[model samples]
Structures are given as C-alpha cells and as structure tokens.
Target: MFKDTNQEDYGSTRVEKDSIGEKKIAADSYYGINSIRARENFNISRENVHPELIRSIAVIKQAAAATNYELGLLEEGKKDAILEACSEIINSNVAEELKLDAFQGGAGTSTNMLVNEIAANRALEILGHKKGDYHIIHPNDDLNKGQSTNDVYPTALRIAVLKLLVPLTESVSKLQSALQAKEKEFSSIIKLGRTQLQDAVPITLGQEFSAYAEAVNRDRWRLYKITDRLKKINLGGTAVGTGLNTSHSYIFKIAKQLRNFSGLSLSHSENMIDITQNMDIFVEVSGLLKAAAVNLNKIASDLRLLASGPAGGIGEIRLPAVQAGSSIMPGKVNPVICEMINQLSIEVICCDQAITMAARDGQLELNAFGPLIASKILKSLEMMKNGIDKFVDKCIKGIEVNQDRCQQILDNSLAVITSLVPYIGYDQASILAREVRESDKTLRELIVEKNIFSKSELEEILKIENMTSPGRKK
Candidate 1:
C-alpha cells in the first residue's frame, strides 16, 4: 500500500512541453501543458474557476464538436470522443482539479486553453491514448478548431451567466411569493407608517409587505429581460471577430448547434467585432443585479428595525430566532439573518463595481479582464440567490406581528390626525394635534372627551381600513 501511494503521488508525473518550456504533469490530469503553466503563472486569486463556467465551457466544446462533425472538418470517431469527454466533464464533479486561477491575463487565453487541454486530453484518453498524446487529437488544431479564446471565452461566459439566471430568477420569484403571502396574512393588521423617521399615517402591515413583493417581482422581470440580451453570443468570431481561419458555414452552423445543445435561445451577433470588444451587456446585467441588491438592503434594514427590541426599540414584529445572538447576554436573540442579507447585498454591490470597472477597462479587440468579470458577476448572482433563499425560509416565513403593540403605537401617534382633517378643518386638526402631543391624552381619548363627533361617528371615521385608502377630499 505504501509503494502504491508513492507511485500515485510521485511516479505518476509525465512530461509535456509547450512554447515556453516543459513541465511535469500528473499522469491522470485532464489538463495539459498550457493549463499547468497557467496554474504556475497565475498564482493570483487562489480560487478555482467557477464550476458553472467549467460546465459552460464543456457545453460549448460539445456543441463545437457536433458542428465540426456536421461540417466534415472532424471525423466521426474524433467527434464522438470529444463529445464523450465533454459529457464526462459536465456530468462529473471534476472542476476542482482544473486549478486555473480566476485572475489571469491574455484576454482569457489561459482559461480557454485550460478548457481546451482538458477536453483534448480527456478525448485522447477516451481514444485509448495517454493524456499528452495530443498528436492523435491536438488541443488547438482539432479540439479548438475554428474557435479562439476571444470568441469562446465570452460565449461561454454568457452561457454560464444565463444558466445561473434561471435559478436566480426562480429564487427571486420564491421571495416575492413569500412576501405576497405575508402581505395577505397581515392585510388587516393596522400599523403606523412613517416618513423621515417620524410618524406619518396609518397603513396595513399587508401594504408594506405588498410593496416588497412588487419590488421583487420587478427584479424578476428585469432578470428575464437581461437573459434575452445574454443569448447573443460571438462564437464564430475567432481570434478577432474576422472569422479568420473559419468558414462562414461553420460560423452560422455553430450557433444553431449551440442553441440545440444548450436549449437556450442563442444567436450569433450580427457584428461579431462589436460582440468581441464590447462588454456593455455584462455591465447592464450587473447594474440590474445591483438594483436588486439595493431593494434587498432596504427590505432587510426595515425588517431589522421592525424587529429591533421587545423593550426599547420599535418592537412591532418578531423575527424567528435561529441561534444565540450574543455570547455574553443571558437571553439575547438577534436579527442575524437580516444582518447577513445586509452584508451580502453590500458584497454584491461591490462586485458590481468591480465588473463595471473591468468592463470599462477593455482595450481594442479584447478584454484581458474577462475572467475577473465572470468571477464577480457569477459570485454576486450565486450569493444573492443563496442569501435570498435562507432569508425567505428562516426569517420571512416565520415573522409574527405584535398586534397589541401596533395598536398602542397607532392610538398614541399624532399622525393619525390626518385622517380627521376631512371631518374637521385643517386648522382645527393642527391645533388638536399639538394639544394632544403636549398633554397626556391619546388621539382617540381627546376626540371622545371633547365630543368632536359622536363616539360611534369618530370610531367610523378613524377605522383602520378607512384610513388606509383615499377618503372624500376636504
């Protein structure tokens, strides 16, 4: 067992050479020379490329193989091997083994080459050849036939982003549903609404939650709109969008094949050059994601404040306690999930800034920062999704209303006097508001004591449901 372990660790290394130099590789590594050099050179970020992107690259390679076979550029056996290898990468959990950093230069050449080498070597193994025996199925010449890093990298990035959007959109929908359910549940529960951190008017707790649901629904719609924009890819625009060594037939057919394979409504960009150089679409998507983050932060902050205290703060709502909030306090429970969402939103907003800068820094022909852009946006989407799911399940669904507290606050607020303005003159309402605030009398008490109207009439006018909507203008 010791000898076998030694062989697995040391004796399994094989030599593979490239233009720069040669390096010893693990015998069973799907990646070849370029990937090994990239791993050594790009020691930045220490994180593996996102697995969604890995799957996206494999999906593209599989589509390319099918297109190449249809165009008679690849033999059926070679195409079969490539397709099988891509399926293996997609279906298996092999992403951690790729080892390419998400921060690299060369307009994503290292990433594209990394995927190419993995697919090529895996195909070679499928054909009963050793990993570096690329003479039988060369990574560049055959596996990456008619494609370039410039084209393939952005195309795969779009596919990966689009793929993630499906789940992210679903998560947002779930959040909206959760908020909507709370709205319906709390619809009749009256609470004091505020502006400028001061009391303003009476509103149903349901209306507040309804607004949150609507905001999330709008975000879901925006996500769908951006997904349509991401479907336009520059797949056939090799090296510089001139389709240099690739034929028009291959260019057009690749899109069709990719659409078929990915089940996405994909199309080739009409101006491949523009697609290759301009990353504005990614920036637009990031901006929309930031908008959702803003909404999330606002909602989370509101929940934290509403759940702030049972004794000191605006203890209008109770959030479900998932864990002990304080280490030292005897009976302390905290709004931890809301705080987590707040921090996640901040992180997403920061990631959007990084993506915006990377998109802006692209020079002519290619952006060397594609990897950075992909990493930021993917991380933002995934983090937001996970955060949203947990928030909905643990926090939103279990929230309980403090009904008596809400009524006590509402009865004491002077802002509810606005509901009396239509019944009384504005001047009278103002004086009454000042008198009520200065004395030890509540709004309901003063109205009853003064006999401003009959008790039943005042009760009818100050009804919570009547105050929530428009009444006769005076």
Candidate 2:
C-alpha cells in the first residue's frame, strides 16, 4: 500500500506521500498552494493579485474581526487573537517572494490564500504552536467562518478602494491648490482662448486656471460620492447571496464588527441579491475613474501644447524638467511626467471599459468575473493616485507662465474685435477683423490703420478682462 508520510520539523510539519516507486510528493504548506493549482487549471494571466489589493485583504480581515468584536459575535480573546495575527501579517516586512501572481481564477482565491497563510502562520506563533497547524484557528474553519469568497472578495475590493480614495481626494485637493496658485500668479496675464481648437475669444490666464481647478474639484466629489455607495458591505451575505450555514446572529454581528474595525461607517447592504448579482457599483466607480482620467488627459494635453515650443508652438507655459527628454536631441526636455500621466489616464479609461464589459457579462447570481473587475478597478485607483501625485509634484507645482508669450498671443488675436463692438459697431468690428486676418497683421495695427479707435482708447477698452465681463471692468 502506498503510504503517506507525515514529517515534523521544528514547529512545522509537511505531509508527504510515496506514490508508485520511490518518488515522494509533498503537499504545499504555504498560503499559495492553491495558487499553484489555479495557475495550472486556468492558465490565465489577465487576473492577477495586485499588491494594493493584497494589502487590502488584510484590511478587510481586520475590519471583519473588528466588526465581530464590536457586535460581541466573537469573544475578546478570539478577537484579540485574530487581530494580533492580522497585525503581524500586515506589519511583517517580507520581500517580493510572498506576493501572489496577479492572474488567478476563483475570484482572487490566490490572494485569499496568501492572506490565510500569512495570518495562519502568525497566529500559530501567537499560540505557541508550530506553523501550518490549522488546529488553533484553522484558515477555513475559524478565520473564514461565516464568510464566503463571494462576499469577502467584494468587501475587500471596497475596502481597498476606500483606502485609495482617501489619498486620491487629497491629491485632487493638492491639484486645486496648484491651480489656485497659478490663477493668482497669472491673474493679470491674458491669452487667446480656443474653441474647437480655433481662437474664439480672449480670457485671463487666471480664469482658465480656475476652470481646471473646478473640474478637478468636481471629480473629487464624484469619487467621494461613489465611495459612499461602496461603503455598504455584503459581509453577511455568505455564499450565493444567502446566509446559508451562517448563524443569524453572526450576520448582523459581523457587519458591526467590521464597522468598528475599519472605522468606515459601513452597514449591511439592504439587498443581498442586488449586491451579489449587480456589479454596477464597480461600473459606477469605474465611470468616475474614467471622468477623472479624461480630465487629466485634457489637462495634460493642454500642458504639452502650452509648453510645446519656444520657437514654433504656443510656448505660453513651461513645465518642470524631471528627466532629459532624448538621448540624441540636444536641449530636449520632454514633458515625460505629463506624458506618463496621459498614458495612465488612457490605461484607466481602458480599465473602465473592461469593468463595463465584465459587469455586463454577469449571467445570473454571481458576476463570475469579479476578479477582473477587482483587478481593473484597483489598478485604476492606484494609477490615478500615483499619477496625480507625480503630476502635481513634478509638473503642476513648478509650472511657470510665459507672460511675454501670453501678451503676444493676446495682442495678435482678432477676438479683440468683440471689445470694439460698443464703439465701432459690430459690422465695422467684423470688417476690421476680417481685414486684419487677410493682411496677416496684428488686430491692433489693423484697427489703427482703419482709424477704428485711438491706440490708448483701444487699449483701455480692449483689456482682456473687459471682454468677458463687459460691465464689471472699469
């Protein structure tokens, strides 16, 4: 008979078996054991455990245990043990070896396994027992008791998003500050404003900066609102949106426990069926991410164009130089950071689309594709957060306005004709602007030659601020 050999190490054990001839096979002893099988089974690489999401799992576990304690579902001793174990895992400074592969099936089962192994081993130490001994707080029996992959995974995603949302909001606030600073610095400067990429009117640099600041603030509010909706936890909804095998007391208890642990003001979701089947929340969050991405992309595009050339392009703004642009191009300082932010925005937009598709692909009770949703959303959050930080620090903070360029563009724009409407008549101003455009001369020069108004009088009337708020300007 083939015999299984149980070998004991110092505080650790390995299960081995002699199959066929003399070949010995050993069972995996770490949290990533299932990951090996999952990798082979699915052979899919698109769904991997992101590090942020992995860290978030620990947060979710803590939140769950905390909720349990707060609601008295778990005794003080048990809660302390669980929390101690979780804390050990989170605080441990392990290298890259502990990280799980990003792509795994079963809706982030690999990450769950990783956390289980780490927490289980740490708990073993806490209990003065050998590691890999599932007896005192077994990974599946005690640690994951009353929890299912369905609810736990999604709850973890929400927690992770919440963690990221804090910093993202802060970054948005920083961006606003930078824009406001620029607004004040450039208040007296004016430039030709564009509509559909063509010169339309004249506006102060301050007003343009204020518009950007408002857009970022709007995005911040959108993200904040989306996160509020996400705070509703599905922890009580065990497998298949049913509290099957879960104690009725444990249901409410866990939510309360998690709320205390996370300090997130979390509540039990009103509808488990909707929570389980509808991934629209992810879509909603993703849409916010997309909007933020679009905003950043627009801002980045504007920066790049504004800093385009001292000789050929607008050259109306200068961005900070973090790295040399090209190896061969002399004095070429590229807007690499802004370009990186733009690329990240594109990636986030793509992730949003992937989230949309995954949400729509859900068939009945479960989305079956939550792994993808989780990965994409988490990725987008991380990218956005990092990109915003870098963009703010490396680009926005050091941005300098070219006042001379601004004045030149403003003086050359035919849009000043609008300011002449009250004095020269709209028909005359229109005729003058057309003549100026045809002759390739400055609008001021054209107005002078046409005897539309004296130079000093035109200067006083055609101040950029006066064009938009006609009555407010003195």
Scored by lDDT, the top model is 1
Q: Can you write out model 1's per-residue Cα lDDT over 1-474, one digit (the tens) per residue?
A: 001112236557888888777778777777678876777788877676888888888888888999999989999999999998888777776654556788887878888888788888878888989878878999998878989989999999999899899899999999999999999999999999999889999999999999999999999999998887899999999988889988889999999999987889899998999889989898999999999999999999999998888889899999999999888997899999999999999999999999999999999988888988999999898998999999999999999999999998887777668888877889999999888879998878888889898888877877777788876433
**Colliding residue pairs in candidate 2:** 47-102, 47-103, 48-102, 48-103, 49-102, 66-257, 67-257, 67-258, 68-257
lDDT of 1: 0.87
Cα TM-score of candidate 2: 0.86
TM per candidate: 0.95, 0.86
Q: Candidate 2 lDDT, tens digit per residue, 97-201? A: 354456555666656766765665566667777645666666666566667777888887887788778898888889888988988988877788888878778
Q: Name the regions of candidate 1 deviating beyond 4 angstroms.
A: 1-9, 444-456
